[model samples]
Target: MSMATYIGLNFSVKLNEDYTEDEVEIDYVFSSEEDRNVVKQKHFTTPYIYEVFEKDEPIWRMNEDQKIHSPHNYEKSKKTFLYLCHLLKELLPKGDYCEVYICWLGEEVEECEGELKFNLNNLQIEAIDIYEKYFIRIEN
Candidate 1:
């Protein structure tokens, strides 16, 4: 019989004002099927970064220095936001007129009967709403 497993996905966004160009960073954790059973038990984490631009000019960028934490970690969330603002300094070429937005995605997983079960959640929408209050809109 095959064992069941669960997987989860999470992400966060931030704005920085100290960068010369807009940027984005996405990170995820996934299970590997190519590894042996013992090795497969370990999850793999992947990180990606991209640039955000508007009208051929950088508008704002995400701060890669920020660390991603579990949803229960409120302190890290605050730090993430602060780091994002720092990156925006240089990314927002439009000066104070430009808006910066940050978002995150989260997922949960469980193991059952030699099988893998996964639950996914998108926290980016909530993050967008929070930033929108500050007059920032996450680019679709």
Candidate 2:
């Protein structure tokens, strides 16, 4: 099975000196199949995965989250969700809270469900299509 994901960044933008507005990408697309095709067919194009490093070690990364597939493909990493957050702290100032929202399509997210605390209304159940997605909200 081909697992696809939609990685979205949600935050607010300053509209004016007196006003700040929330923004979300309804049209932003991050398809894995499309990315794979690009990698296979396009040699000159830049790779999509980007990361920042400190002292030759990465602070954060968005590439494949350590996948080991079948007999040929094998990959692993020491990174975990908590470790990722710890790394993010080096980039973000103190006292900022980040929230991650994950809700899969084809299932009713039934308002405030999961091991982690998150707003159910923010789930936006009807917006999912074409891929199994994961949304991580990085707030500063």
Q: Identify the candidate with maximal TM-score.
A: 2
lDDT of each residue in 40-124, candidate 2, tens digit only: 2322122222111112122122223322232122111123333444444443344443433222222212232322222222433
Provide TM-scores for the models. 0.25, 0.27
lDDT of the candidates, in the order given: 0.26, 0.28
Cα displacement (angstroms), candidate 1, residue 29, comes to 12
lDDT of 1 by residue, 1-140 (tens): 21112111123245344544323222122323332222223332312122222212111121122223233333344444334444443333332222222222111122211211111122232232121102142211
Instruction: Output the lDDT of residue 7, model 1.
Output: 17
Q: Judged by lDDT against the true structure, how good is candidate 1?
A: 0.26
Model 1: worst 10 consecutive residues (lDDT sum): 111-120
| Number of colliding residue pairs in model 1 | 39
Off by over 4 Å in 1: 1-72, 94-140
Count of backbone collisions within predicted model 2: 0
- The model with the greatest lDDT is 2
